[model samples]
Target chain A: MFEGVPLTWFLIVATIMFFIGIYGFLVRKNLITILMSLELILNSVNINFVAFNKLLYPQHMEGMFFTVFVIAVAAAEASVAIAIIINIYRRLINIDVERIDEMKY
Target chain B: MLIMRHELLLVIITVILLLVEIFLPDNRKHTIILPSILLFFIVTVLGFIPGPTGELFGGMYATTPLILTMKNILNLGVLIIFIQSVNWLKKIENKGKIGEYYLILLSTLIGMDYMISSGDFLMFYLGLELATIPLATLAAWERFKEKSAEAGVKLIFTSALSSGILLYGISMIYGTTGSVYFREVMGAFNATPLQVLAFIFFFAGMAFKIAIVPFHLWIADVYEGSPINITSYLSVISKGAAVFILMIILYTVFYKIALLWRDVLYVTSILTMTIGNLFAIRQRNIKRFLAFSSIAQAGFILLGLIGQSQLGMTTVIYFVLVYIFSNLGAFGVAGIISNVTGKESIDDYDGLYRTNPLLSLTMMLALFSLAGIPPVAGFFGKFFLFTAAAQKGLYLLVIIGVLNTIISLYYYLLVVKAMFLNTSDQPIAYFRSDAYSRIGLLMCVAGIVIIGFASPVYEFILSLSHGLY
Candidate 1:
């Protein structure tokens, strides 16, 4: 039971993790790092989902079911993203995001 | 009897394609592809019959006549894409890998089918990921090309970022309303500041897909960087499904907060059109130019969204139908040229009519249709969208829309003049396009010319709607 733990604690922690992931995504120049940040952001959402399930809607398993689906989707996304990153690396011989602008404005 | 008839057919087709990949030799792959294309077309057509609309899986899955019609339109688009890509797909690097292309494409199509027919947020999110991940792979399908790889990188990261933002918003919505079902969400649609913030984030997520002005940074880059078929797929099919789903969600789930969304859409419509047109004028690359043009078209679609009436939605559907034809025709021309001479910029079209009159003519008509010239379906589409907005007393918005059309006309003619009137001693050599591409182009042209004079298609599109307002 999450009796002693306030819902606010989960929400606040989740929000902090979400912003940190966003900050890394925005500022990071490495492709792999950006992807890791993306994973972090998705995981933060998972945390929010699970917390909401435990706190608010334990009767229905919708939130937990959604969290599982999100995890599966994140796995698919990460696999594809990494495959693309590696493909880019083969062409440019580097994974630097700044150098990947071959078709920029 | 299975509830999701089309999805079941799609899955069966996917399995057949995968089996074809396994059993067929590398050289014999092309032979099986045509049959598979025919099979997909047949199954999709057969699946078009109207059935009982039902909600299965406790409102997670849904079926309706409108969803069926939209799915059929998407199938039609994919069939054409198959035709359009055959010539490109037959090249050396892609020959044996044809099955992979169809696999990813069919999987993405399945995702879109799910996205449109979903009754709840969970199904929508899963379907979206299923569609998007493969699309990013397809964007970089040309593995050796640095540009294609760059496009793949850009698409995946942008897509991941948007989905992340969307999930965060969805999480907040769940926390507040304690439900993700549209039926339940509508009941709890209180326009609190927190609710509005969540809605804004949710809209932002969809906006990236629709390529509205603010989140449109990825459009031109990805369009220019990817191969032509993928560009057309992204601009038309993917965006079409996203726009269709966005309309349904706003109309059904967020209908209670109509006033809030209408105001949000009004400013978005005006800004989207003006800025899109302004940026389009400066484009040198043909793909990027069309990218901006599509952004402007998104603005016009948003115009129809704000009218808050069935007539408004009818206008949107009509415009999208016409838009698919017009935009694909333009891209088909670019694809042919890119294949023949590898020229991509607007300047490369100089004196094209002198060398290749047929393609040049097609290009001219397509560009005219895009510019909303009379006797073309695009003119009617835009006319009706503006009228819909005007009927809602958004006169200033209509005026901006018209002005954007005029500005768009100028850039479209820039390519036209270069193709027909400009003289060049060394124009691109005349080259014969493949039979499949020619058929695809012919379909686009026919849709553009005939769908305009004919009134039945518009009426049918209107009839398809059960009533959003």
Candidate 2:
């Protein structure tokens, strides 16, 4: 079944995942949920990279190298973000983004 | 081997600073200063050493003299930020995280250096994401402040959106052209409609980082909510580095589509200037006002990009250097004033000249420079920008740019008028800056004045742009 999948299928799946991430990012009220959306978007990017690596440039693993770096950085980013979110929770007692509008005009 | 040694030295210094901060007591963590300064010196020296602009890691990493100069400028900016933040950091109740702040800032700076020097798209995206994600956290460093949290949310959302668009554009380009290296893309581009569409998407994403109009809504709120130091970093260094990279990428990858982008940029220039100025006119919050004005200045930089000539690159880089000092001077003054009065409104600046003549004069010079008035670096910056635009026969864009400069002067002068002209109900208390911030501000003021008179600096920038392409 996987062998029958065309390159266009990979693009379509990636696009779907990207849009879902966007939707979650826009609709979610909690900071953590929004961060998860960001992660999903990143994962979609990784999928694109791997797919292109497999199909377009099999001789070189440039896309795979980028994917590894992206994963590593995303891990670092998520840890820092979670720490900040926890700090915000301690201060405000909630993670709802709408309630954090104290700075907006 | 020598270049690798230099890179290794930088890595060691950065890691050692990080480790030293982890072990130090909260109060004594100020000792991180010695290493920070040492790292700055090392990076500066490394930046000047002549080396071949060779590709590393199978053509992914590339460095040139121009990229080295850009890195040096960013290092200098980060050093100033470190010095400027000393007092501001001391004032924070939660001082334990101070070392972490420096570490993150250094990492972001490293990422930016890589971003500008990157010849391949893979490294470019990696560097961009690394530089940006930390800034979103920095926006909310004041966890107790609700606005800070809001700013963080807005920044992350916008960044995620733009990243998605940028990624899609990158994928499309790869699909159509079968390459991710910039030079390869340029070699393969046929000016197809799909390629143009991809370029537009990529440009739009970059425009967000530069905070040009229509992509600028988050800027004012983010600047207001973030710690003043971080806001200064975002407004000047972050945006400036992005523009530097964008200029290089466009010059290399999309020279074939210059005519199309020039027309698009011409209209963007007018709209950005008009909108940014009109919005700036109505802002009461000083940070927000400067934020919009910075957006307008981004539009002016876009005018330089439209020229797409060697002179245009020189003008853009020169203007960016002047802008670094001018905007940082303004923000530094704002930071000092906010520390003292806890007020951030234009009206609250009433009778500031009476309270503190030195700060008032410094601020006046900064504002004058920002408005492109005579005898200040800002004037020369705008003059070069207009000259570059006019060289491209973008007479209409130049006319609008000049007119917008005049409109911008009105609002900038309003702050001056408040400080010198308006009467106060209560005497504004004069506050003293620590030795470091004072020196930083003095250096910025000195740079503004001296760089204006220094013709060789302009010539150097022109030669550097020629070297870049």
TM-score of 2: 0.94
Collision count of model 1? 0
- Each model's total of backbone clashes: 0, 1
lDDT per residue (tens digit) for residues B92-168 in model 2? 56468777787778778777877887888888988898789889888988877777876776776687667767876
Q: Please give the lDDT score at residue B82 for candidate 2.
A: 75
lDDT of 2 at B344: 87
Q: Which stretches of candidate 1 lie over 4 Å from their true place?
A: B1-3
User: Which pairs clash (backbone N, Cα, C closer than 3 Å) in model 2?
Assistant: A103-B147
* lDDT agreement with native, every candidate: 0.88, 0.82
Best by TM-score: 1
Model 1: DockQ against the native? 0.88
Residue-level lDDT of model 1, residues B1-469, one tens digit each, is: 4568888899999998899799997668878668877888787777777666677888888977777778887887888788888888887778778888899999999999999989999999988988899999999988889999888889999999999998888888888888999889888978778778888889988998888878899989899888998999999999989988999999998887889999999988888999999999999999999999999989989999897777887888788888889888999989989877889999989999998999998888888998899989989999999888999998888888898999999999999999999998789988889898899899889989998999998898888776543
Give the number of the best model, judged by DockQ.
Answer: 1
RMSD in Å for model 1: 1.3
